[model samples]
Target: MQAPEFLAAHAAEAERAIAQVLDDRASVVPERLLEAMRYSLMAGGKRVRPALVRECYRACGGVDDARVLPAMMAIEAIHTYSLIHDDLPCMDDDDVRRGSPTCHRRFDEATAVLAADALQALAFELLASADIEAELRCELIRRLALAAGCQGMVGGQMMDMQAEDGSGIDLMQVERIHLHKTGALLCWCCEAGALLAGAGSDQLDACSRYGKAVGLLFQIADDILDATASSETLGKSAGKDAAQHKATYVSVLGLVPARELAAEMLELAIAAGSTLGEGGQPLNTLAQYIMGRDR
Candidate 1:
């Protein structure tokens, strides 16, 4: 399949895993909270992270997407939860996400907060409860927790908040924030996929390197888009970063340079993916998409 077609197919598979995981727990979850979770979790987007998980597994010679289905769901769930909290009034304060009202905007603030919290816990629960070998389960849980914890995404967020005034920051500092805030979870997705697939150290290392490049690429793309794209086109507020004077690639390096950096990262990601040979096409394509995406 071609790039768009391949990504679309994998996105569908990710959504299917998300649906099955949520549907199975509907009986036990509270109705309103479930609806809140559904609102964001089901909101259509690229499903890039879960797709990476599945694609990395395949690239590592694992034929079964189901083998990593739970991991896919868990990764996506954690991502969705992060979005919910990120768009809170105290954070990005965004009204829209993926072209619709954000979780807090769609539901009450408390509901959004609680739902996000629940989704975070649910991700670990899925990992811990999966039918995989105990060691694999433990490893997934341990890595995911670190990726999502204070030293990773949360720490990056704190740095982001501190940097919003736009003074006393450099490109390196901005990249550090991007690495912690965005790169960690993405790295986990790629590594976790290979780990679950029983890939050797070399394959795992290849995927991990690809993830690191893609993670930076993802944030750089966002920075580029924020400076150039319309809110309508982006499915969320645009130019808000500049308005807030926040330090981003676009803010620190300018649009042209940011785009150039993103290209470099994409090329690096593709090179890393090439190490996986033919099965790595999906990852290479996804990396290209990260650079080319307008929204």
Candidate 2:
């Protein structure tokens, strides 16, 4: 199958798995809270992180089922939570997301905040409850916590906010912010899958390298899109980086250089994926997809 088609198929599977988890059918919860959570969690977006988990696991000779499905759902939940908070008034203050009202816009600010919080907690719970071996589950939980905590995504968000206040940040500083903010979780997705499959260090390192390159490439693509795409095309606010005075690859390295850097990163990611041989075709194709993606 075509690589983009393969990725879309996996993304569809993740979307279904995520929808089931957010529907509150598996566990009991307040109806209103569930509705609020479902409002954003069900919002359509490319399930890139979860797809990574699936593909990486598959590349490592792991099967997808009860053992890995819940873990995939957990990552999706965490990603949704991050998106919710990111669109909050204090954050990016975006009204639209995924071509619809953001969670805070659909519900209220307080509800949005609580929903994000709930999803964050649920992520760890889902990881902990995965049908994997206890030791493997523990590792997943640990790595996830670190990826989402202050040392990673949260810290990057903080750094971004700080840079937005007219604070002059250099190119390397911008890279640092993105590496932590976006790269951390992406890296964790690949690493977690390899770990779940008990992949040896060599394979693990390849996935890790692929993740790093893919993560940076993804961010650069986002920056390019934000600079060039319409809000309608993006399904969300565009030019947010410039409006918020945030540092980005485009802002630091200029458009041409940014695109060049992304191309380089894509090649690096594809090379790393090729190390996995045939099992890495999905990864290799997805890297191309990310590079050529419009949204």
Candidate 3:
């Protein structure tokens, strides 16, 4: 299937699964809190991360969504939690997200924070209770914890906050920040899929290489979009990086150079995916889509 079609199909599945997960918890979760969580979680985007889990699983010979859907739901939940916290007053302070009022704006700051916390906990629960074997489930939980914790996304976020308007920053430093902040979770999505499928070492390595390249490629495209796209186009605040003097590919390498680098990363990702033969085509096409995405 084509990348767009594949993403759309898997995104639909992920949406349904997410809604069911939330609905299952409706009785126990506070009404207002559940409403707040649903507000942000249902706010739609491309669902790229979950789709990656499915694609990587399929690419590695996994035949069933049952093997990977838990990972998909877990990643999306983690992603949604991150977005909620990232939009908090102390963070990006953005009023808009996915073309709607941000969680903190639509709800109160406390509600948004609690909603994010609940989602984070829920993500772990999904992984821990996944129908897979105990050892595999443990591995997934460990990897996800590492990806979401101080060593990964959180550390990257701290670096990003500290690098704002700071002088003497370099390209390597900016890449380090992005690798953690945004790339870590993306890389995990790919790795999780491969693991869920019981892929061979060669396939796993290919997935890892593709994940790393695509992860950086994704952030570079985001930087370009933030620099060049409009708020309506992005469905959120644009040009905030420049406004806040945040370190980014465009900031460190200039717009044209950053775009060139994105192209390079795309090629690198494609090359890695190519090693997987037919199963890797979707990954390659997804890389192209990411490079060309305006938002």
Which candidate gets the maximum lDDT versus the true structure? 3
Q: What residue pairs clash in candidate 3, if any at all? A: none
lDDT (10s digit) by residue, model 1, range 131-162: 88999999999999999999999999999999
TM-score against native, each model: 0.96, 0.95, 0.98
Poorest lDDT segment (10 consecutive residues) of candidate 2? 1-10
TM value for model 3: 0.98
- Model 2 residue runs over 4 Å out of place are 1-3, 24-27, 64-66
Write the number of the candidate with greater TM-score, choosing between 1 and 3: 3
lDDT per prediction? 0.90, 0.86, 0.91
Where in model 1 is the C-alpha error above 4 Å? Answer: 1-3
Alpha-carbon RMSD of each model = 1.6, 1.8, 1.4
- Scored by Cα lDDT, where does model 3 land? 0.91
Q: Rank the candidates by lDDT, best first.
A: 3, 1, 2
Worst 10 residues of 3 by lDDT: 1-10
User: Candidate 2 at 267: error in angstroms?
Assistant: 1.3
lDDT of 3 by residue, 1-295 (tens): 2347888888888879989988998789899999998898889988889988988888898998878998999998999999999999999899999899999999999999999999999899999999999999999999999999999999999998899859678999999998999899999999999999999999999888988999999999999999999999889989999998888899889999999999999999999898988998999888899989777
How big is the positional error of residue 100 in model 2, measured in Å on the Cα after superposition?
A: 0.6
